[model samples]
Target: MKNQNFVRNLVGTAILAALVLALQLLLGSLKLGPFNITLTLVPIILGAVLYGPLSAAFLGGLFGFLVCISVISGNDAGGFMLFSQKPVITLALCMIKSTAAGYLSGLVARSLSKKNATLSLFLAAGIAPVVNTGIFILGLLLFFQDTLVLWANGQDKVIDFLLFSILGINFTTEFLVNLVLVPVLARILRNLRFVKQELAV
Candidate 1:
């Protein structure tokens, strides 16, 4: 039984990795209103709730790797030219923020699942963007504070730069997209769970 579960998880993780990569490559950024919505976070959140933290971490790592690819390929949003100047810090910030987001999403879902499974899933889904963006902002401040100042040249303070210039439309759209889509996707998956049980027979 343990081995079977392990195999199931291994297969599931592989599928998810493929799915995330496909989405990242195919539909990574979709422009909606004034925002560019990133679809990669969806798979990370789904893996967290369905599998667990380690699986989520793996997905997050994949997501971050894709981000690096975007940087190198000249498809990144804010530009990663700085990455060429400071490779270690840039890579670490990217990977750490994404990995933490995934890990925390799983942790939050598992902790709340006992009390209320649906709520747990909903909350877990909702927090994905929050965790992703929050960590990103914190990472910028910690690792790129000096460089960020140049970006925020006209702003009175870093907070002003972050909130008004950095996070305004894009992050808001990303958050809303996750809030609405995650729950719906999770619910659909939950409804389809019976099919897996049937397959077990």
Candidate 2:
């Protein structure tokens, strides 16, 4: 039984990882400004709700790695600009934000599940993109402020430019995806017999 659970988890993790990779590669070029639309957050949230924090972190790390690749390859113009200016910090920011997103989503969901499972799932899903984008914004402010100013093109408020021009669409899409999709899909998976048994354990 233990081995069976292990196999099931391994396979599930692999599937989610593959989904993340495919989404990142396929929609990776679709950027509103400097950031990708981030269709992968759904799977990351799913992994968090189902497999656990570690799996979610793994998925998020994979996403970070892919983003790094895109930046290095000059596919993500904003990210590439940051990378060109501050290579190590850009890399660290990329990795840390998404990783923290995934890990926190899972940890929060698991922690809150005892009181209300559904609410916990929704919160978990909601928090993933929040953490992801929030940290990215902070990273920009802390580490990439000058670049932001350049991108702002002498705008009166760089924060306005960042919030409205750069991140508005990207953050909305990611947030809505996690909000609508994660709950429905997680409920479906939780209804499955094997998953029910695993959760019970």
Write model 2 residue lDDT over 1-201, tens digit each, in one string. 999878877888898899899989986445576667778888888888777899899999999999889889998888889999899999899899899999999898788777777777888988998899889889888888788788787647797887786567778787888788887776677676424423321
**lDDT of each structure?**
0.73, 0.82
* Cα-based RMSD of candidate 1: 3.8
Give the clashing residue pairs of candidate 1, or none.
none
For model 1, the stretches where C-alpha displacement exceeds 4 angstroms are: 31-36, 155-157, 194-201
What tens-digit string does per-residue lDDT give for candidate 1 at 1-201?
989777876777787899889998988787643224688888788787777788888998899888878766667645365576677877777787778888888888778776777777777777777888887788777777776776677445777777865577667777777667776676666576611321111
- The deviation in Å at residue 119 for candidate 1 is 1.6
TM-score winner = 2
